[model samples]
Target: MSLCQPRPAESGYGSETSLRRHGSMLSLTSAASALSSTSTSSFKKGHRLREKLAEMETFRDILCRQVDTLQKYFDSCADAVSKDEFQRDRVEDDDDDFPTSARPDGEYNHNNNGSKEKLFSPASPKGINGIDFKGEAITFKATTAGILSTLSHCIELMVKREDSWQKRLDKELEKRRKVEDAYKSAVDELKKKSHYGGPDYEEGPNSLINEEEFFDAVEAALDRQDKIEEQSEKVRKPRLTLASPSDAYSTIGTHRFANKVEETVQNHMAYSIQEVGGDANWYYGDLKLLKVYRREVEENGIVLDPLKATHAVKGVTGHEVCHYFWDTAVRLDWETTIENFHVVEKLSDNAIIVYQTHKRVWPASQRDVLYLSAIRMIPPRNENEPDTWLVCNFSVDHDDAPPTNRCVRAKINVAMICQTLVSPPEGDKEISRDNIMCKINYIANVNPGGWAPASVLRAVAKREYPKFLKRFTSYVQEKTAGKPILF
Candidate 1:
C-alpha cells in the first residue's frame, strides 16, 4: 500500500472511526495555531509597555522627591556642623588653657632657648559622596568668610558612598531611593493614569502600601526655628529716657525713657564746646558775652574810626564804620551781651577769643587741604596755628568725623543767624531776594541751620558766584570722603 494514497475506511475499518480520527487531527492543528496567536499577542503587549516606560516622566518625579529629601538632609547636617564647630572651638580652648604662661622671675634670660611649642592640627575631614562629615575639624573664622565653600564641599560629601558614617549620607540617599522605587513599583501595578497620560502621584499617594506610615516618620524627625527682634528709635517711635548717662551710656533700652532725648540734646551742646577747647558759648570781636562764665580783655582793644584818618584801624566805609563801632563797644565794655552770663567762670588774657576757621584748599593740588584758621600775614597775629590742621564744626550732620585733629563738629541754630543779618529799613517787612542777600552778607555770626537750604544760600550768595561755587564744591568733596555723608 502507498502512504500518499487515501485509505478507504470501508476496506478494513468502519467509516465512523476513520472520520473521528481525521477530525481529531484537524482539531489539534487548530489548537496549535490558536496558541501561536496568543503568544504573539502577549509579546506585543510587553514590548509596548517597555517603550511607554522609557518615554514616561517617572524619573522627574523621582528627582523632585530626591531633592526634597536632600534639602531636609542638608538642613539637619548644617545644624550638626554648627554644633561640631562650637565643640571643636571649646576643645581647642581647653588645650590652650594648659601652660603657655610666662616663667617665674621678672625677665626672660638672654642665654636660654625657648622650648618648642607642640603643634596640633585638628583638620576637618571631607563629609558625605563626602556629604556628612564625622567629627571633622575646620577653621572657625576661615570657613565662614566664604558662603559657597561649605556648600560645595558638603555636596561632594554626599557622593562619597562611605559604608561607615556616624551620620551616613547614603543611608539618607537610600531612604530617598526606596521612596522613588516604591513609587515606581506602585505605578507599574497601577493601571489608571490621569487625562494627561502621566500618573497623578499626589492623588494616589495612598497607592503606596506604607506611604502614610513613612510620611509620619519623616514629619516626626523634622526641625525648625524662631527669633525675637529689638526695636529702634524713629520719628514715629515713642519717647524714651536715660537715668544716669554720666555714669554709663547705654545704646539699648527695654522700656522707653521719658526725658532722655532732651537731656541728650543739652549734653550734646555742652560736650561739643568742652571737647574742642571751648570754655563758653560766646562770640567775641567787638565785645565779649558769656553765659555761665563771663570774662573780658580790655587791653590792646581794636581802635575805632578816627577824624578823617586814611586807613584807620576803624574803617571809614558805612559797613566798615558799623563793624569798627561794634568791635570797640563790645571789647571796652567788658560785659556780656547776655546779662545773666556776666560772671567769669574762667578768664583768658588774650583778646582774640571766639575765632572761626574756614577750609582753604591749595591751588597747586586739589587734594592738599591747607586748613588755615589764623591768617599768617594778618595784623593781630595768631600763635596757635598747627602746620597741618582742619576747621571744626563745618558739616550739617555733627556725627561725621572731621578730616583733621584741628577739626571739631557742632550744631548751630538757623533763626539767630537770620535775625542778626537781615535789617529792615526802619519798618519794611517782607524778605526780598536783595534783602536776604544783604542780611546774610552783614550777619556777624552763624546760627544752627542743621542742613543749609540750597535755595536760600544760592540766592544769598549769587554775588561773587564764581568764588562761592569753588568753595562749595571743595567743601562737598572733603565731607563725602570722610563718612557715610548722607543727604
Candidate 2:
C-alpha cells in the first residue's frame, strides 16, 4: 500500500481494542499534568513558609536585645534612687549641727558658714554614688529632683496645719479653766451659807411668806377680786386716763436710755432665734413640743444662767401673742409668780416702764424688777417671708422706783419673738384661725442682785418655763377666739 493511501478497514474487535487503548493513553496524560501542577504549587508554599520563619527569628533577636538594655537601665535607676535617698536622710539628720536656713527664693544657706546651696541640685557630669551619668540618666536625675520638691512642699503644709490646730486647742483649754474656777467659788459660798442655817434670819412680812404660803394667799386674793369684778361689771366705769405724753411728769431718759434698750432688745431677739448646740443641750418638755436650753454666763464676775424656750402654737396670730405679752394690765393675771405689777411711766404707745414684785421662794429673798417694755412689728425681710412681732423687756433704772432691802432688785432681759404663718384658704376664702400658726421664741435672762443657789434657780427655771409658755399660748387663744383678726 502506498503511504498516502487510506488504511484498509480493520476487524470490529481490533478497532474497539484500538479505541480503548487510545482512551487510556489520554487519561494518563491528563492525570500526569495535574500531578505536576500540584507539586509546583506545594513547593512554592513551602518556600514562603521558610522565609516567614527566618523573619520571625530575626525580630525575636531584636526584641531580646531591647529587653536586655531596658532591664539594665532600670536596675541602674533603682540604684541611683536608693543612693539619693540615703544621702538626703543623712543630710537631714545632721541639720541641727549644720544649721541651715531656707531663703525666700527656695535656696538654703548655711548659717554657720554663710554659704548658699540650691534647693534642687542639677545633674552633674560625674553621676551620683561614683557612677557616670549619660543622656537618660540625666533625665532620671531631673525627675527625681521634681519629686523631692513636691515632698518638701507637703512637709511645709503639714507644719502650718499643726500650728493652727495648736492655737485652737489652747483657746478651748482657757475657757474650760475659767469655768472650773467659777464653779469652785460658787460651791464654797454655798457651803458657808448652809453652815449659817440658811437665809431665814431676816425679819419682814415678805420673808415670813414661803413659796407655798405666798401662792395660797395670792390665789385667794385673786379669786376674791375676780368675784367682785364679775358682780360690778354692769356698774363699773372706765378709770381716769393717765397723764398724756405731752404732760409727762418725768420722761424715761428717752434719748440714750431708749437707744440702749433698743440695742439690748435686738441682741436678745438674735440670741433667742439662734440654734441651740444639740439635743444634749436641750431639756425637752413632756409634750415634746417645747425645747428649753440654759447656760451659765458670767457678767461682771457674777454668774448668770439664762433660759431659752421655743414653741409653735396653733390657732393664733403673732400680733395677738405679742400684744398680750407687752400689755401691763394683764401681767398679774397670767404671771402667777408676780405678786403685784404697775406701770410707772408710759414712754409711748408701744413702750412702757413697769415695776413688779415676784412671790417669795423659800430660802431666797423676795425679788422685784423695773424694766422698759417695748413692742414693734418687724416687716418681712423678703416677699416670701411672713411678718414678725417682737416684744422686748430690759431692766432700767427709774427715779420713782428705787431699790429696797425688803426685796432684792433683779435684772431681766427678756424677749418674745413671734412669726405668723397663714396657710392660703381655698378659692379666695378669707383666712381664719384654722389657717393660722404662731412660732414663739422666748428668752429670759434674769440676774438676781443678791446671791441665790444656782441649782435652785436653774430647777425653778426648768420647771416653770415650759408651763409659762403653754399657759400663755392657751390664754391668748381663748382671749382672741372672738376678736377680729389682728393681721
Candidate 3:
C-alpha cells in the first residue's frame, strides 16, 4: 500500500512470484499516467481551436446581418416611392378632364382630397431596423442611388483592407526577419545550454512545436493574401480600345516615342559617318549638288532598293528647317511630289498619322501611304554639344481607312533626322539668327509597294530629292525671314 517506500521483500532476497508481481504493477501505473496526460493535452488543443473558429464566425455573422438589414430598408423605400407616384399620377389625370370654368374660386380639388391626405400621413410601416421612410417621395433614381451609396461603403471597407497591401507585405517580411533573429538566438542559446544539459532541457515541452505552427500559419496567410491582391490587380486592369490614331499611339507612352527618336537618330548618325557615299553606286545631282545613295535587295526576283538622300542647306538652323517640315499647312507649297496629303489622326502634339498620295513618277504608278510622323527635339548630350532636331515617319496600319483603289499603298519606313551643329560665334560676334549657320542632314528610305524598275526609282530620287530639299529650305527662309528664330 505504501507506493513511495520500497517493499521489505523487494529489498531482501525474494521469491520469483513476488518479483514478477512488483514489476507488473509498476508497468501498469506508468501506462495509466501517460494515457491521462495525452488525453488532457488533446482536450485543451481542441478547445483552443474551437475558440478561434467561433471568434471568426461571430465577426462574419455580424457583417451579414448588417447587409441584410440594409437590403430590406432599400426594398421598402422603393415600394413606398412607387405607391406615392402612382397615386399622384391618378389624381393629375382626373383633374385634366374637369372643366376649369365650372370650378368655384378657392375650391379644393376634391378628386385628390383623400389620396393627398393619405399620401402625406405621418404614420407608416416601419422599414428595416425600425427606420420609417413615410410620406417622403423617394424616386426610383434616388432609392437606387441610396443603395449604391451603401454598397460603396461596404466596398470601401474591403478597399481599406488592401490599400495598404504593400505595407502588409512589408510587415510580413519584418515578422519573418524577427522570427529568423529569434531562431538564431535560440540556436545560440541551445549551444550554450548543451554544455549544461540537452537543448530540450532548457525549453519546455511542445515549445518548438508551437513556434513552428505559428510561423507556418503566418506563411500560409501571407501566401493567401498575396494571391488575392494579384487577382485584384488583374481584375482592375483597364480595357482600352484604339478608336483612332491618337488612341493607337497613346497606347504606347511618351517614353516609347523618345526611345524611337533616339534609335532613329543613332542610325542616322551612323549612316552619316560610315555608310553615306562609301559605295560607288551613289549618284550625284548636278542641279542642287546633292548626293543620293541607293541599296538594292532582290526578293522573289524583284529588286527593292531603298534610297537615302543627304544635303546641306545654309542660312538656317535645323530647328527652323524641321519646324517648317512639320507644318502640314505649308507642306503643299514646297513638297511638289505629293498629289494629296491630309492628317487622318493626331496621336500627340508632335505625332500624327497622315494619308498621303505621291505624284506619278513617269513610268511608276502613283503611290499612297498611311504613315505616322513624329518630331522630337534632342537636347545636347552635354553643354558642349549642339542641340539637334529629329523627324521620323513610318508606315502604320489603320482599320478605318484602307488603301484606295486609285493608288497603290507604298510600304515606306523612314526617319528623316536633321541635326544642327551650331557654328561657334565668329570672334566676338553674338550668336544671332542671321549669323547662325546649321548643317542639315535629310535621309529618306522608301519602298514603293509593287515592282517599279530600279533605274526609274533611282532616277526619281536623284532629281526629286534635291529639288525637294532646295524648295523646303527656301520656303523655310521665306517664312522665317523677318520672324523671330525658334529653337
Least well predicted 10-residue stretch by lDDT in candidate 1: 306-315
Best by lDDT: 2
Query: Measured by C-alpha RMSD in angstroms, how accurate is candidate 1?
Result: 42.4
* lDDT tens per residue, model 3, 314-416: 5667777776677576665556557788898876677778998875432234579988777666666798877767677877788766988667787666755
Write down the RMSD of all candidates, one decimal each. 42.4, 36.2, 40.6
Per-model CA lDDT versus the true structure: 0.26, 0.62, 0.56
Question: In model 3, how many backbone clashes occur?
Answer: 0
For each predicted model, how many residue pairs clash, with residues at least 3 apart or on different chains? 28, 0, 0
* TM-score for each of the candidates: 0.12, 0.49, 0.44
Q: Please, what are the lDDT tens digits per residue for candidate 1 over residues 1-487?
A: 2223321112222245445544553453344344334334444454333332332233233334434544554554455456656766665576565644455875533311211111111122211122211111111112221213323333334434243463476778899999999998886445222212332232122222233432322222221100110111112232122112111111212222213322332333233223123634332222111111212222222111100001111101122222222132232122111112111111111111122233211100011111111100011124442111101111121112233433222222111000112334446555432232111111111221222222322222232222222322232233223222111
* Poorest 10 consecutive residues by lDDT, candidate 3: 1-10
Model 3, TM vs. native: 0.44
Better of 1 and 2 by lDDT: 2
For 1-487, candidate 2 gives per-residue lDDT tens digits of 1223322222232244445544543443344344334334444454343443343343344345434544554554455455656666666667767656789998987542211122113331111222212322433433334334333434454666689798999998999999999999887555434423444532233353344533433345445544654565446443321212222212323544677766766686566778776646455554576777777666663447777888888888888788778777666445667778889988876688899998765445688999988887766779998877888888999999999978899898888998998889899898889899999888888887665544545655666678779878877887777666776
Kindly report which residue stretches of model 1 are placed more than 4 angstroms away from their true locations once superposed. Answer: 1-55, 100-487
Which pairs clash in model 3? none
